[model samples]
Target chain A: MNVPLIARLAKKDVRVTVREPYFFFYLAFPLLMTLVITVALGSLGGSVPSLGVCQDDAAAAYLSSSGAVDVATYPSIEAVREAVASGDRDGGLMAGEYYVLLYAGDTTSSERAALYAAVSSALAAASGSTETVDISVERLEPRGLSLQVRLIPFLVIIAAVVGGLIISSSLIEEREHHTLDALFVSPATPFDVIAAKALFGLFLGMVLGLLILGLNGALTSALVVVFLFFGVLFTIGIGLMAGVVMNSMTDLIARMKLFNIVLQFPALVILFPQIPSWLGMLFPTHYFIAPIISLTQEGAALGDVWWKLVVLVLCDAAVLVMAAKVLRRRMSGMLHLPSL
Target chain B: MTVDNPYKVRNTYVTGYSGSAHVMMIEATGLTYRYGDFVAVDDISFSVAEGEILGFLGPNGAGKSTTVKMLTGQLVPARGVATVLGTDVSRHPKAVHERIGVCFEEKNLYPRMTVRENLQFFADLFDRSVDVDELIRKVDLEKWASERAEALSKGMQQRVMVARALVNDPDVLFLDEPTSGLDPVSAEQIREIIRAEKTRGKTVFLTTHNMAEADALSDRVAFINEGRIVALDTPENLKLRLGRRLLRVRTRAGDDFAEEVLPLDDDATPDRMGALLRAGGIATVHTLEATLEEVFIQLTGRKL
Candidate 1:
């Protein structure tokens, strides 16, 4: 572990990966997936939260045009209250003597967030003030959550998956292009090259995972951030191991399809809680996403799920060790491994 | 097409005290390597003297690359020792690597990186300051320095590979088919760089199947086939020892030309030539020497 040499080699790998057109193509999956999902969640949500506006044409027109929710015109503030009270609409806003808002307790936080944005923007426009619009709220019940939040864990984990894939591509291209031979023949030992590859995978995976977290408004928590870090390591370890099994771009792409099925299997299993938790835990990605679901959805603290983090670290160590061994052997004239 | 008289073999040595005696930079004794049950390098013994080029010539799979790999410490010989720069390659591959360079037969440059970036990356690996522009200039590729390696023509890429090998300014260079597939001008450019390396007192171990390349660049040519060194000597000596120089005689035969060949090395050639001239109707006379390929065939009894 020559730090300077490792740093230099890692820097070179990063440069080569960024320069490859496929890196952007490779990264676009999670980015575009996140972008589309987030945008869709913001506008359409799980379903549009309808709001009733009474005697406030400005707020009604503004909310309707905002597209965050459907705004129905009510004849009076009494009608708006009845609509929100019955849960036919998510919330209500009216301008009679004062600006008032009525809320439904059954709406999830994301749905309420969309309603809040639409109501605030509509109220601010109606009052002709950029300052925060003050309004009184009346809730029919209380607050809760639903299935929409589950998508957040999936988005963040997919970003880590892409990060790992970048590592696999860099490793495969080096062997396929025979640049690995060039590296070894030059003063680089197998440890130097493989370590550099692992470092690059970690760096890329962290960046992507952080981006997904930022998009989901999940970066503020230290626990989620730590879990995300180890989660990335877990996936990156898999990515490095994937490189050991691949030599050509076509082969990597082909196997990547299978890897996708394996990586997503655990996430998809979450849809059916009736399936045994141990069965889902059998996959290493479970160590990653389960902690995420616990921390984000269930509000579990570090003490509650610290064991999963340790499991993640162990899994990363095992995968990295296996990846390093096979990759080193592959570079050492193991023609059966990667003769390309 | 031979420009170098005996091809810079005997003079590169240091017997007359112009400098320190040129030591053998590469030596292999009874080196053997096997791929499972098949032998790839078999009991090969050869040495490359300092500042000299030894062309290891063979056909497609004649153990040339395997022998070089053993010498460079990439592959450990199954049977004997490969000493590079007075250190055993298997024992001190890193020690040997810090002072040697190798250009593989495959085009292994990073495709997405610019030529300068590719060269600079390799140069960084050696921990030595390399003037990449000078190397790029040496291969006549100053224009393509900013161009990605994959964007260059095949010859230019080969030149980049050559320049990359020179980045370390190694004392001994092992080039495996640098100009394997190139236009004549590009191939000649690589040959010129090789000549310049010898002039600068750098030992080169060139391996190729092209007999002309072997003849033009090698100080001593070693013919390898079926994992063995069949013949090893200066090209002229090898040709002279196993074969003969001949004269091609042509005479006017109606609308066609009748040709007869005479061995120049044989006795009574002058009488035979004089009698042929006296008989008249001579059209053309040309002298031909046995090529290195012909010498290889004479020794191994197999065409390369």
Candidate 2:
């Protein structure tokens, strides 16, 4: 392949996309959404739980001094009851003849359990008594990524996918405008055009992936970058294949909807831990998602995720090979190939 | 029941150089192309000499573009032997592409790029440097050099296409309807560029359905219809072989103008014209000659 020609074509593509009015929408919109989602979820996680306490209760004084919860004092027991009933606090604590925990009737089961634990702990501490639970929960594995933190890799993958779609759209535009005819007549071969397009997609994918990672303050390693590169290639391969199969932008969008459904499912599965990991493995993106979360969140070494990386590389190679073959067939006017 | 070779039957005249001494820049023998069962170009053979403009004149879907595509190495013919600039196109398409230029019927320029950038991109493709400013001036696009191709008019875009086709200073330039759908001024400008290329000794294979363009610019014109070439010769010869000579006389007959047609080559033509002039009241008399379009229709039984 002619490196200079490929570079020139890629530069031209970058210039066109950058100058487009929707450049932000195509390249930055995903990262924007990531930022918005990250901020929104971060705020929710940082919110302190509130508790209403009786003014005369010793447990209330101790809980107030703890500063773990937003403590709201009530003038009387009746007021504490009213506060819990009115949903002014998450729950209430009153010390009298018996320790009582009051919560709203509509409180969810998890919230009610949390309120019970807090009241019990505060009363025990006030009474100068130590109470231990009978059952001990043992930890088998170290703590890994938080749900929101793990989502960083997913968002980065999404950015790469969007990059692929943008490249696909650019290729389709070239075909519709008949500029491919001009390139064919020029000295540039079909390999040069394909390589340029693939490299353009790779550049966008890498930049957008790194941008999202940086935005979330996620840890990055050599393995993470390598995995991101392969993930981007896999997604861009889909884009190139789609560009070859579809003739118009309308057809491309319609077809990409189906592809997005398959590709985006792993992101959703990663969010809900109850889903089977093997199910995510059925999709190619699972290889990238699993290893990225392990590397960035679990502090796994490259050797720790060696098997997953192997699968990801194999999948990327398979996809890139298919994409290159299809692109060659299309650009060379061997149109009799069966549609993907 | 095969048709006779029309070029052999007609008296050949040399417009650029003697036939024996002129070098062939492009040669195709029995070139054929098909789309499934439909034949797009069928068993056509022709050659273009160096520094000559051979106009492939035909209506829409007459295999003109297909021929150009094959010659430019865009499409591989199913059964044919074609060479361009001393290289077999099918075996060495890239080598051929480097030495040839092609402007498609459609304005296939990069719409997002400026006129200068568009020419520069193609120039880089050939690895041959070009002076962008001079090319822009040659195509008369200097005023719009900095404008994007999409922002220019169809005529201006066509000028950019022409400029791009000349970026490599190609040995052979294939223009498929380069002047189609352009204003008169733009059309004339493109025609002048073609003439200028001829002056520079660049072989041009111009394809167009405009008979006037072919008559005015072509060193030899080939008339194609239904994927087959019906006749190939100089425009003048094509017109002369199938054209009839006539004398038109206009006279005043009883205060009303009257006209009469007489055969110019007929033995009694002089007698007929003298009788008409002696009758007096003769206002005008002129000889009528057939045009290329008329000759096209007479030979191919189709209007251009």
lDDT of 1 by residue, B192-279 (tens): 9999999999999999999988998888888787997777777777777665588999998678888989988778888889988998
Who wins the DockQ comparison?
1
Judged by lDDT, which candidate is best? Answer: 1
List ranges where model 1 is wrong by over 4 Å: A43-145, A271-278, A333-340, B1-21, B245-267, B270-288
Clashing residue pairs in candidate 1 (N, C-alpha, C atoms within 3 angstroms): none
**Residue B12 alpha-carbon offset, candidate 1, angstroms:** 23
After best superposition, candidate 1 residue B155: deviation in angstroms?
Answer: 0.8
Q: Candidates' TM-scores?
A: 0.79, 0.81
TM-score between candidate 2 and the true structure: 0.81
lDDT of 2 by residue, B146-219 (tens): 99999999999998999999999988999999999999999999999999999999999999999999999999
